[model samples]
Target: MSTAKPSQFGVAGLGVMGVNLALNIADHGFSVAGWEFSPKRLAAVQAEKPYERLKTTGSLEEFVGMLERPRRILLMVTAGDPVDQMMDRLAPLLSPGDVLIDGGNSWFQDTQRREKAYREKGLRFIGMGVSGGEEGARHGPSLMPGGPAEAYEHIRPVVEAIAAKTDQGACVTHVGPGGAGHFVKMVHNGIEYADMQLLAETYDVLRRGLGLSPDALVNTLAEWNEGISGSFLLETTLQVLRKKDPETGKPLVDLVLDKAGQKGTGKWTVQVSLDLGVPVPSIASALDARNLSAMKDERVAASAKLPAPQAALTDEEKQHLAAWTHDALYAARVVTYAQGMRLIQAASKEYQWNVSLAELARIWRGGCIIRAKLLTPLREAFTQQPDLPNLVVSEAFAPVLTRMAPAWRRVVGTATRLGIPVPVFSSSLAYLDSYRSAELPQNLTQAQRDAFGAHTYQRRDRPEAGFVHSDWS
Candidate 1:
């Protein structure tokens, strides 16, 4: 009875994500011992008798003891203080070479601090980003792990065994040293926010402007999903639009509240982008859209007072509206992804992480929420030019954007005329316009700044002159 070998891996939380991940590890032929602080959760997991090789225990000491030497423990608890507290508890129990992975949405700085602290103590700490909700956790998820190279080697077998597989490879990579994994994940979520907002705007514009029923909308989106527009989120949108209320027989999404929720990652992305001087206006606009959506009562009250546009689409405009919207959606999405990737690039440069955008696109091809057909070309673009200044000018996407820009303008114009708020669409379009223009009105802004604050301005006409003050007064 006592001759059995110790579990090969350890999971120190039995939450939904933890249990599913433990089961996934066991499914990959690794014995995993799980521990949970909550007795109810522990009892619930134990009651299920999930996996024969996955053992659940309430005792923390026993859980730590069950793992083989140089233990590989994944802490899938809440982000922030809980992760630190868990680290404190596990530090005393772990050996010098034992690995502790914090698989939560923690801030990158915190991860850096923790990794530095743990390295000093001779323990390996990995800040891993796990994407693809519960189902992906049980089946396969995109795993972004950043830490010491040696520590990555320690857990590579287990991670690769359980990660989503595509033709490129497993959906897991040792992102970089320090907090690059979490940083990339944060940007991933920021892209997700922009992508979702674009979808929402598409849905709203089509539903309100074209007056299409849910069934018609589903058909339209389903056709889009078959082409280059295919993505996990769009597929999920199709599913949501197809469902009917069990009790009322009404379209389920129609009955749900208009408010949206977030878990701070999008805000963090925008915040970090500001620090890095990267413009992520698409993401920022998406975050603003969510915040505005939360003021349901204010919007409802304002609806009664504020006057909406009375302009109507012509017959030709109505006929071309859907096609225009499809192009607009795709174009805006490209811009959104461009913004997110640029932010990641800036962060990588600042942090000296050297994260490979090609590898990220490769891994995101499957399992992750933002998985899309576009990632193939995106990967190719990065592979061709690792230091590409912007995705908009890439050989793969420039012609496409040029071809689609007219339709995008039409969609934006139609939405504006109809008084529909396509925040992500308009902002992404503005970002594109600003990037392409050689001359902007910002010279006036610089002059105003100098006039007000004595800020020196660089003159374009003076070939050799440096920054100078004007006598415009």
Candidate 2:
């Protein structure tokens, strides 16, 4: 393969994400070499008005040779088999101290396995999660990098320079060793699912229940952007609501298809939470809602077979509902984030990742999709109490939850009464209620399990260290 002058950084797979990230690196003043597997993609990139510091080559051998010693190569390819395929091609070309970074929405288990394999070969593997879509990639994205601490120094300058920054610092950090970065990213996506689903449910409630027009909704969201409810998604939601369909002169959002698409990170998050025995009701409900949304035909058929909503709210009641909905959404968001943080805590313990929850909040504050006004308080909460088990119970948030409890209940009750399926809203309330309750109905569940499957359970009257069995005839 043909060789070129060495670059300080190399990015493989010149797709949208790859190309933008390469430009971002080059914009940060680092010389970047990029590789594209397909000749067409290579030609397309070459045709672009090139950045002086950015170089492209189609050959993997030539790409590897173009990187400086102890090379740092960032792969933005598709996850799963494609990542493995790239690793196979690069393994022989990389030297002992050379670093390989996977910047994709990959499963954390795969990252752990790959890191182990690469470490055995005296190479470093970083499973990095780069958030922020095409725009963020071109400008600045939040970066979560997990690998050996020793190897981080090699790529830290480029990473920090290209990452979004807040008053705290750049939105890039060594999350932990091995798969921690991907694991955190998985939870981030799950939270995003919950966030978007909650917003959609809120929209449905306001649009259908309150009969608010798209323009009205957009104004409301824009107003919310200046308040505690402000977030990137909320800001983006305003943009979506403001768009008009050129063909029909209707709101673009109304004209768009309802079938929500997913790339499996939400599913992976739920699966990992189940594996770890962490309750992520809001996230799970969000994922389930997407799947349910996908079955559009079945839902339409069922709508014909099933009864339509009959309960209606008065104008005054609708106003009250809107006010309560704001508090409800905020409370639900708190629970959703708490649940996601809990999952990270469980994974950190199981994997000994030493993940900083405060840092997570800080890094996520700027570049990521989930960035919000709420994360500032969240970061402060975690900083104040690093080992805080749950955000709802934390000092900074508990008072907010306490105040929002009544309004949250009112919104959920109103949605239920109106026959609006607020799955995320309802699930988030359920999660909060379940978390706050000192007593639950699990005793009977334990009894049933013991009776049917001989699964021993602890007694409520005694210490939980002993698993006692009961015979119910």
Looking at model 1, report the run of 10 residues with the lowest lDDT sum: 463-472
Q: Which runs of model 1 end up more than 4 angstroms from their true locations?
A: 1-3
lDDT of 1 by residue, 162-254 (tens): 999999889999999999999999999999999999999999999999999999999999999999899999999999999999999999999
TM-score of predicted structure 1: 0.99
RMSD of each: 1.0, 1.6
- Winner by lDDT: 1
